[model samples]
Target: MEITSVPFLNPEEYSLFCSFFQDFDNDGETSVNKSRKIDEKNKSLSEILEVIDETEIPTSKFEIPSSEFENRASEMGDWEQGRVRKGRNQSPATFHDGETAEDGGGQRRRLWVKERSKGWWKYLDSDECSDGEFRKAFRMSKGTFNMICDELESVVMKKNTMLRMAIPVRQRVAVCIYRLATGDPLRTVSSLFGLGISTCHKLVLEVCAAIRSVLMPKYLKWPDQERLQEIKTTFGSISGIPNVNGSIYTTHISIIAPKTNQEAYYNRKHTERNQKPSYSTTVQGLVDPRGVFTDVCIGYPGSMSDEQILEKSALSQRSKLGMLENTWVVGNSGYYLKDWVLVPYTHQNLSWSQHAFNQRLDELQMIAKDAFMRLKGRWGCLQKRTEVKLQELPMVLGACCVLHNICEMHNEEMDVELRFNLYDDEMELDSSRGISVNALQARDGIAHSLMHCK
Candidate 1:
């Protein structure tokens, strides 16, 4: 009630206090009427507190002695104390359309300012950053990144608000890309992108979802009738294997050992061979002649062999329904010999024709292997164990595969530094050697023709 006893008022506080005098000083009002007007104003206490909050008043200007507050607090009963926080915004001051100034939470939400660092992100986003630096940081050329952002803009874009502008789609995408490219922890990504750690994590998942839903169906999909014919012709020239639609390979992406059914995700082969613990999920990809994935099956447990993964894959289901239509997809010895699938012989002794056939077929398989290497290399998230949960790993993996296809389609070359040996320290799946009666004849015919031609 006494301005002289209080510290200095900021402009908002000064204006607020001045309004009381301007209202109460009007001449003909009874005490009861004046009190009722004051009560009506108090009904908008929530919004008034908000206006006060916008003024960054120095704490030093408002500090009260601890002993004075302690003495007052000791005198207050529970009902009075609770009243300090009650009934705000219940009869809010509304605008023409009845919108209130503050949220429905009233005074329940804590008021504080968060200071986020922007130095790293600022440099990375500026012209002073060299092309090499930008590429190294985000693992893609500026053009490629821009193209991806444009493709996802409609879905990944957010609406702005009165309090703060929404982060631009490019920046949101950069946060996601940097996280995926470097396999950085959310803490590091947050600092680099000037975002909260949880925000960084959320951006990656959101962008990955966008990529899966929007870009993946366009960039990564099974070949059509014409595309299949082209692929078969290309494979025929490479290894004299006719009707070879694509080369398929399965690779494991490392993940945190999940709590439920840990053994299911355990890689016994990798653990035994490397003499250490390992956990992963399987990603089976069928790549065309240019090493771009046309079909991918992701999120199978790491313990599943390539044969088992293939069986569970959509590719197998389609093949069983005669969708493949007598075309062949070649895999290594880890897969079973089937009418629509070809595998290299794995016995200790092999005839000259069988070895020749194996070598030629292996050349096609290597296309897929090399593609996997570049996929892991360019998207570093797939190289190391990721923090994404088991259930959501599919979107992340599928996003990587789609991006890899986009890069390949664009003729984007991987910087030599990003090259990774996916096979190094990785154990191959045990061969399942299942045989089909008709497959042997098909393989024998191809091997004889190939041997004779060579």
Candidate 2:
């Protein structure tokens, strides 16, 4: 090709010549001094026409004008159109086609990245859907959900505005309740609630803590004197047992093996078919005649016997100190016979009055057992292996017990499936605690009264 030097070509002519080199491959780095001199003057059109006429340069190569080519010089190599995109300080040749050598080697360029998921909490919006959807999604009636939200608002609501907004207290409490009601894993709850996994975990703990601290006292407590009289009357109606203050029992909740003390949480009695320790936590409950929990003692290791749990409990302290007075709480053979605690005679031989006492005691025991059944039934989370950390499981279970009472107050229907298939922890006979002389006299007195009065 003949090269010609002319004072800059006219605008139109320069465009035409520049378009001709668009297909040339400009691959790999070249120093500034050795780089192509794109600013240099080019031959006039008349001179380029003479060269094209003499040489056999293919016409097909430059058929398409530069105006028609897409600018892909940043990442893709245009073999036909060899032009390369350039950095501000670096020449186009400083980077090979498709090589990520810009702004130093292989470091990722900063980008406007969005890490949040949008509108996951939308499911809780009442106006967006039907009441049935709300109940199914949150596992509670809208009214119940809102009531809980209102009560928890003061505690669960965020107080800071310093950073990204905190999750609304409603959503936070809902996440915790929904997890408990459904026994769903944290990941599932997080996805359903449109929260991060860590956020969901935090919310569960926070909400449970709030429920334990705020609602538990209001819902689950030792009945006052008047309430105690009412409870005794209810028990009397169920069976002829007199002075029955409450019924007591224990149920074990499954948990993952603890990292701190694996053996402590291991309930040897709950061994798998292969005889492996099944780790669990025990929740001991005292229920009124209506099958509502009045008192709950949670966080006892499953390995601890029921009598041990009861002896160490506040209820026992209250009873031993004469706080209960004439009031007597009934349990199965698992508890020691005490002046304030009545257990059915487990001896093989029995008098007719003793037989009558045992029968009435069995009825009272069923009331407490059924309370646990209804509790675990209503909140299926306790039925399954609770995935919460061992330390947090106490508050979580305590919260569920409180909710159980609230649900009972509101007449929340028991889950039919769980009601029939309720789990009952086996009871052990602790008859060796040596029945109190006063307790034995009281039991015989009640039995004699029942026999003669009837």
**CA-lDDT, candidates in order:** 0.83, 0.75
Scored by lDDT, model 1 comes in at 0.83
For model 1, residues 352-437, the per-residue Cα lDDT tens digits are 99999999999998999999999999999988878789998898888889988988998887899899997523335444545677
Highest lDDT: give the candidate number: 1
Output the number of the TM-score-best candidate.
Answer: 1
Error of 2 at 189 (Å): 1.1
Q: List the residue pairs that clash in candidate 2.
A: 23-80, 23-81, 24-82, 29-93
* Model 2 C-alpha lDDT per residue in residues 316-424, reported as the tens digit of each score: 8887788788888899887888888898888888999899888888999998888887777667688888777787788889998888888778776654555735554
lDDT for residue 93 in candidate 2, whole number 0-100 = 21
Error of 2 at 439 (Å): 1.2
